[model samples]
Target: MPIGDRDLDGIIDVENSRLLSTYRKFGVVAVKGKGSYLWDAGGRRFLDFMGGYGVAIVGHSRREVIDAIEDQAERLIICHNTLYNPTRAKFLEELFKVVPRNMSAAYMANSGAEAIEAAIKIAVKATGRSLFVAAKGSYHGKTIGALSLTWGPRYKEHFSKLLLDVHFVEYGDPKSLEDAPLEDAAAIFLEPVQGEAGVRIPTREFMTSAERRCRKAGCLLVIDEIQSGLGRTGRMWAHEHWGISPDVMTIGKGIAGGIPMGVTVVSSDYADVLRLGEHTSTFGGNPLASAAAAAVLRVIEEEDLARNAERMGHRFSRGLEGLEGRFRIPREHRGLGLMAALDMRLRIQEVIPRMISNGLISTYSGLRTLRFLPPLIVDEDDIDTSISILDTTFGAIEREKRSM
Candidate 1:
């Protein structure tokens, strides 16, 4: 069912010839999108369970977001970061209202990594400490400061000298923090749910306990909500689930509905730590990105996407549960809200092709977990369709293996 640009293979060939070899493209060519589905180059539509790494919360081809972009582009698309912009201000105002308690300001950046860079700078400046704490299997971003916080060996091995002293702790274990030398650390950063680490969830008690420890020891609490925030976890912010607010919050991914944007929101006490010109981004608060973000925010609130995400996530989980081995996959499913990962113990790399053939899109992650981040705009019917396809294929695998 692929459409557009002659044929699917044609586009693949074109991409191979024209694009850089460093990046890989899936075999399918996405021609267009709407709601929870994307049409391939041959016009075959598949449910986007991956949701572009959980960025399109309102789904693809959203009218308001497109219109906002169109309108902004027609007016003023490119502007320097040195000056203030109305659209940026509007986004910040709306952002401040929904940001967790005590978050007083925001510093906009171009992506999640940039946001982390800003966050690390803020923590170091506020506390006058060089060290920060991050958890094993936690993903912050790929930039230097963010990469320092990222504990994956694949992501951090080559640049050992470039990275800083970010103590690694066991995720979901507050006792790790309790045992650490928190007094000298600048900040403790974590994701409410580890997305790249295969949708692992930290215990709420562990998170709250760490917050207490940070408070007592003068360590800053910085949450990398780039993936878990913005309704992926059903809650608007994943940290809200633990009832603890951070001194600084970094948000990206779905924040601007597929646009390149990230923001570091701060509490009042630490808001002004970075003075004027202390930290500035060239494309941070441009009008067009802000306009896109504003529209995305409105749609999220109007549609009550968080509620939808919560409801649909449970339905997806229940639909897939109790079949880890039955499906011939060894996954134990875990995640919060719509951000679910099915941890498969099998080599299982071929599951994705079989899934694509059955009209679904997903990706594998840490622990061999296949991550599912269906857009917030996805409905019950889409969920049902996806499960039906998944159920059929998984059952077939199990049956074929048993016969063998």
Candidate 2:
């Protein structure tokens, strides 16, 4: 049946009934998006700071990305890895230019989880080892293999038996990583910036020490950049900020301009470990995703979105910090580039809906942290508007508290 023929409310009801209750719904039925804003089914406009969990870096419905997708769809959409296509080849060449210089081979997949899964498989194949090390508060992906390396008890408690031999170390502590047993490890997975754990930024010393220890132990260092990569942190890759290189890197989210695409990039030394028949995906590196990815790279370079992310990030962070003084509230502001968080003194559950009601959209990390991931295309005006809405919401909440 045509989508237009179906009643929106009825469709939602059917979805709720048929689909597994895995995701927590937010009530807003987002129908469209462009640049830095979203429009709900009722035509209510919202300033989108959530960016679909960091997938809209280049902005929603960008013309270049949309054009590429449309043009590729006209010719071909899916061509299995069994055959080589021009768009896919060009995408690989463009992709390598932005990633670490040493990264030579890339295995494409459909999501961040698949990218982490590929990284795990390649690391294991290269080192012939089974154990892995990951940082506390790090989120890799939800798939069993990737979940094994992810460091959240809430996510792992139900699927404990499916996890692999993985050890957790304190983030931003060089001593912890240096002391971890890595002799028999295949790889140590780390996020350049822990995203789900409230946009935690690690110290330079910790990252450098981890790299050195990984080298010393001859273990593959896999950096998961699914949320922190592709200009989200004002750099092509977040690890670039610390001048550290990983043996393998998993990247996704915004890599293909919202198209479902993930990549595990491996250095030349370990690229051949995953033999031709050993690792493959049916829909990986297809023409449509490749075309979209290539266009995104071009736009990022042409528009210099990375530098914009840096400039705007500073402005936004400073604006958020100002709130603490104005409201006399205890808060902490932490971020790198555009990926930032505001840890409010009060619970965030009450503020999120209020912000939305006032025409702003954001997300929460943990219980009290409000995370902001606005599109790279966001301007000074957009930032200011979001901050204003936040200020009004905070003031209203405070007034209510005092009245009570």
Candidate 3:
């Protein structure tokens, strides 16, 4: 292995031997990225449709982010919250501009899970209740507190005892929320667009019902926008599509362009619940990450990337929808903005590697859905190229199956 890069075999071997087996391994050893493309150690370029799991909202290695990181790094990296760093203050000011008007305060953390953890604490303190309601097929985060809200059993069965008391309800069904036991609940958590459930977009009626139910039951509405926010869903926040404002909101993924950051925005109605020193993070709101996040906000506003996502997302959705008719494997396409999915009759495990081989990298939500989270900066040309890659890869796979 070298300083700047490593051979593919060496990189793979090192990761396989030294790292935990929690991650689904991919063969491409990516060494560099710029805009909507990633370059592997072997010098092959890949159209980054995955967008680093929606963390590259402004595209990889964006110059503004780089400059912000470097400039902040040179000046200062960490200034404890008690000291009040200007960079952290600046980041919060930028963040508040995009969130709901009632969301008057925020707590910054290092990842979505951390933000969710903070929200859990806030909800508990505000309502004095321990029970929560979350939708089935929901994914808030993997941390213990956040994982309690997540629906998948596989992720939390062993650690269930450490989790919160959360009741699961069917997503996109207003009746489910109405039937749910919410009187004693602190909050009802949900995603406007379910990403890990394969880009499931709920009906507007369902969202309105949730808000109504929360209000009637005296429970807070907590929206998890870790995957669907920050212009990825064509809107500043996915909740905008349904015209709902959450009492508490958790956002992460691309908040800092690439630097790790998570935020829990609390409405003024419940902002005073948490006392000083009741909950705090050692690394939260560090100047380095704050500076990068501030730059990301500026980029989103200056580039009008949210509108671009709306335009390009329609193009991408149409292309994926067209494939459903041409290929036997494709069953349907579902998505909003750049957050989209193609459901196939067959599992996409094998199809994933084949797409990588064809210079396209995608991800999956479940066994049969091919999830695409392209950069918001993606153009019509990028959408066409990705569609072409999907066509070629599916054609080859179908041909192989026929010959077999």
Candidate 4:
């Protein structure tokens, strides 16, 4: 039961005994990470493709983020929102410069779920409506309020009784939203690019139509950019791709350069829904997280990581598509920028582990899709390396299947 750099299996056993049984983890016990690579406890190196579920956009252990956090930790860490702090003020000022023009105010929190919860409350208080609508296959979060808006039977079945009144329509179909009863709904929650549901990108026409419909119905359009925002999709915001403005937007994951933070950016008209005392978080806009966020914004601007994501993502997608006929199942690529996925005809549960064994770490969105959220800082060489590893893994799997 010793915990000092034990074997992978031993560490996993120790984790099982001590941690809650909520996560399905891989065997690798990551000890360190830096810029698209992770080292296991055994000193084995892995080319990271998951990016900690898109939380490492600026790259793991970025120097700017580390320096900012250290500096802020030495100066100040937490201060109640009652008092105005310089770090928090600077972070908010910089944040406003990057978000959508319609979004003039922000509510900072600790995670994506908290941002979603705040958006829900804001929508309810603003419109005085009790019902909500979301797209099918959408994933907002797992918290009580967020989960109610999330549309997945598996995640909601056990906690069905605790959810609220939420109606779901087919994603990427404008007619579905038009057919739903959204006139009386408080808000319509959507992801610019559905991440957990396998990096589904909607059509520009569909997005514009949904925006028009929501405006006509007087329902707040809440765009959840938790996984797709912050330059992950080659733009400051994924909704920018469609040229549509949302009433409220929830962002997290990589907003603070891997530090945990969530922000609900709201339009100026609806910003006053949550009164001063109605909604507040003790650590929402603390100095450390705000400092990290300010540093993240600077890094994204200085490094031009969003443009890199666009170029690398296109190259990676083409490489994946090139392997279409070489495997037992055809590989179809879909996504924008660094948030990409390969839709395989077969379940990728075993294939992902094989890729990990080959020193390339990845994740699967569902039974038949391998999702890739490589760091935005990745270069052409990194993309090539990942593609090469995938080619070998797919070839080996095909050979094994043929032998059987």
Could you say which candidate leads in lDDT? 3
1-404: candidate 1 lDDT, tens digit per residue: 54348566667777798788865345777878898899886779998998887887899878899999999999998777676678888888788768887988888898999999999999999999999899999888888888999988987778989998988889998778788778999999988888888888888898998889999999899998998888878889998898887999999988888889999988998988988788987788889899999999888888989988899989888877856645657568886889988876554465777778789997667535688988898888998898888787787777788899
Candidate 3 structure quality by residue, lDDT tens digits, 1-404:
36347556767878898899899987889889999999998889999999999999999999999999999999999888889788998889899999989999998899999999999998888888999999999999898899999999999979978989999999999898888998999999999999999999999999999999899989999999999998888899999999998999999999998888899999999888889998888899899999999999999999999999999999998998788878887899998999999988888887999989999998898899999998899998999999999999999999999999
TM per candidate comes to 0.95, 0.97, 0.98, 0.98
Q: What lDDT score belongs to each candidate, Candidate 1 first?
A: 0.85, 0.90, 0.92, 0.90
lDDT, candidate 1, residue 115?
92
lDDT minimum window of 10 residues, candidate 4: 1-10
Task: Return the top candidate by TM-score.
Answer: 3
Error of 1 at 36 (Å): 0.4
lDDT of 2 by residue, 1-404 (tens): 64452257866886689899987666677889999999987788999999988999899999999999999999999999988899999999899888898999999999999999999998888888999999999898889998898887988898998889998999999999878998889999999999999999999999999999999999999999999988878998899988899999998999899999999999999988887688888999999999999999999889999999999999998898888779844388899999999888888777888889999999878888899989998999999999899999999988999999
Report lDDT (Cα) of residue 79, candidate 3. 86
**Whose lDDT is higher: candidate 3's or candidate 4's?**
3
- List candidate 1 segments past 4 Å from native: 1-4, 17-25
Q: Predictions ranked by lDDT, top down?
A: 3, 2, 4, 1
TM-score, candidate number 1 = 0.95
Using TM-score, rank the candidates from best to worst. 3, 4, 2, 1
Q: Per-residue lDDT tens digits of candidate 4, residues 88-121?
A: 9999998998898878899999999999999999
Per-structure clash totals for the candidates: 11, 0, 0, 0
